[model samples]
Target: MNNQDFPERTCLICKDKKDKKDLFRLVKTGEDKYAFDEKQKEQSRGYYICKSHECLKRLSKHKKIKVDTDDLIKMLNLLKKGEKDYLNILRAMKNSQTLSFGMNMVLEEIEHTHFLVLAEDISEKNERKLLLRAKELNITYVYCGNKQQLGEIFGKDEVSVIGVKNKQIARGLIN
Candidate 1:
């Protein structure tokens, strides 16, 4: 049998088809609707967490994301395979003055950029507005999957609130 003959699995994040590897598959029953199917819980509109902060960072920096087929393949190698700790991130949220993931990605070592990247789903207008403002203020900022990653860096989860190095909310989301 050829690769085409084999049952194909689609990723919800990038919306591409590939035989299951280490991808976190999801099933989307309807438009903008999806479910995490760890057990292959019936292909509906499965999404995979293959798009990690790295890829998100690149797109954010470029200020655009093209809906391309290969882009989907690129996403597959970027994200993590499972849910991260929201709580530990929460704790870090409280302790650390701030956290940012993309554009100014949090590498093992960070040199500068006194800004915070709020990772969450927002409109293009919002993204542009925030980017402009961050530039105006000379502050670092980026958006990601959710604000939770900010919390994770802070050692907790479900963080509705995120702070920057100066102990204040980032202008992007706060505004």
Candidate 2:
């Protein structure tokens, strides 16, 4: 019933704790060696990983990993390069794009807390995730048709994507 009720161990990756019985421990015993320790008998520097592949990727790249007690975390393993690149792309995407809402919504649509721009008849090739994210946000979405027209209304060079960020994000969006 309680987290502390179990015999727990902390995950070296997320620094969260789980019952030690559930975590899978990986130990680094030598320069290029790794092993899974079921009994945790090995004294070598070890880490615990959760079952998800994404979390496993996070574990492999996390900086505090120690192959030996004194060894500085020199670099992540080579297989994580592509995953690291993917994270970099996500960082850039967040900075480059954002959602906007109709100014009229401030007066006319108090009933609707959020919105999704449907881009009524715009090209779907590039703005796909923007649409999906709108649905995921469960906002009031509209398909105004014609990216060019939408861009004109928003005074942007191109427009097929937009979202009405919640109050928490509104301040950040404004500044």
TM-score of each: 0.32, 0.28
lDDT of candidate 2? 0.48
What residue runs in model 2 are displaced by over 4 Å at the alpha carbon? 1-6, 28-34, 39-46, 63-175
The digit string of per-residue lDDT tens for model 1 on 1-175 reads 7854665665444556655653555555454444445466674644554435543344334322233344444443334322243223334455454654433243321334355455565446546655665576666543444655544554556443232554343343333
Superposed by TM-score, candidate 1 places the C-alpha of residue 87 at a distance from the truth, in angstroms, of: 9.3
Clash number by candidate, in order: 31, 7
lDDT of each: 0.46, 0.48
Q: Give the lDDT of residue 138 in candidate 1.
A: 69
Q: Give the Å shift of residue 71 in candidate 1.
A: 12
Model 2 clash pairs are: 99-163, 115-140, 116-140, 116-141, 118-142, 120-145, 121-145
**Best candidate (score: lDDT):** 2
